[model samples]
Target: MSATAPTETQDLAPVRTESLAELLIATERPPRPSALSACLTFGWRAMLKIKHVPEQLFDVTAFPIMMVLMYTYLFGGALAGSPQEYIQYLLPGILVMSVVMITMYTGVSVNTDIEKGVFDRFRTLPIWRPSTMVGYLLGDALRYAIASVVILTVGLIMGFRPDGGLLGVVGGIAVLLVFSFAFSWIWTMFGLLLRTEKSVMGVSMMVIFPLTFLSDIFVKPETMPGWLQAFVNNNPITHVSSAVRALMDGTSPTTELMWTLGWVVLLVGVFGPVTMRLYNRK
Candidate 1:
């Protein structure tokens, strides 16, 4: 008789389920990272993206420089009687404007990550819920700092002197960074809600342009019509710009600073939770 084909049980070796379970459970799981640690880790990851793509710095560096040059030359004489004199007022405001404008990119970046499915992986990680969002703001804070330094350097070279000296400059920049960090949360919310990066950017520009241009960044609200002045004076950007300008000018910035800080608190308070909600749902 022909040899019987090997039985089905003989054809396949048995799987060692016990050994497989042992292999899987052999090592103890490490403790999860703390919230602060997780946030900083993700923040470092954001910085690494910049490191790999150095061109990302163009907005922080080149854009600020261009704003300094263009405004100082273009509006200096007409607005303040001379380029040098104009920069005395323009530099601080321009710094605020430039930094605030770039804040929108945080949203763009978040949207890009979402589109690339990076956020799906991020959500799976055992980290603090808000760490990723905070990380993006922290990374953008560095970008704000870079833009501040760049603008200040260009301003100084162009004869813009700060009466408040080094301390004042540092203080002003610190305030701007704080506000910018808070402001970025709004965009982060948009990033989660918007379907595309371009939509996020477009909406950001629409909001930012009116705010920057309408505020005291380029001119005194006093020069505008009463209706316009009312809006400008109440504008959050006006408060921030005035605070920064005062700090740089060695003048008391108490009222303006208080307003700026209040707005910062409001922005963070409102947008922070909304962004988290969207983030969790998305």
Candidate 2:
């Protein structure tokens, strides 16, 4: 008679359930997917999206073509020595610009996800939280890398080969990529802050345009007024420009890249935590 009652109580004990806060507080770092494997997987997925929706490729592909034509043919001769010379100078700027500009996608896509409740679904997954942004950033960088390759290929065809040899060219590109990746945290904050994709675009434009133009992207900073020149000279983007130019020219500068790397370190230092905080609040 007691066996039936004993079966009910003795058979099982209630499992403890963790509160969300408890789970989060006790959470360990998610196991890392191999960086190389993750990169390839994420990169291919992103590129596949571009392949399926040809329109999405516009930012990387179409933008460069228009930028090259608009800057080179339209303003190159007036701005630089000649169209050809401008192409040589402008191509590097354009390459850097293209990658830097693509960082806007971070916020825009994040904003889109927030607006569409995509992130609501994302939170339910067991993966590393930062992996979402990490994947997006790396994938987008891959997109930018592909775009840079395309731009350089076209530039080579259009007589814009780098004076720098293979190693120098690779180093220059590497710096550009690192700079892009570091600056992405700023836009990631923007993306997490805003809820709409369009707002992301608007805010990004406001910040990016002034920074890009204020740098020596098209014109040398020396040509600016003394007051503006001082600011422009000190701008991190200018350091990047100087470094890229030096790299392309094969002139090993004593401290040019140090400055560029310093900017990257500074940006990561400031924006990285800010982005993480903003994301947490979201």
Clashing pairs in 2: 107-191
Please give each candidate's TM-score. 0.93, 0.81
Compose the digit string of candidate 2's lDDT tens values, residues 111-211.
77677887677667655556666666776777777777777877877788777877777888888888888888788888887767888899899988887
Give candidate 2 misplaced runs (Cα > 4 Å): 1-48
lDDT of 1 by residue, 139-238 (tens): 8888899999999999999998999999999999999999999999999999999999999999999999999999999888888999999899999999
Q: Candidate 2: global Cα-lDDT?
A: 0.77
The candidate maximizing TM-score is 1
The residue-level lDDT of candidate 2 at 120 comes to 77
Q: What is the lDDT of residue 193 in candidate 1?
A: 96
Cα error, candidate 1, residue 197 (Å): 1.0
Candidate 1: residue pairs that collide: none
- Backbone collision count in every prediction? 0, 1
Cα-based lDDT at residue 180, candidate 1: 96
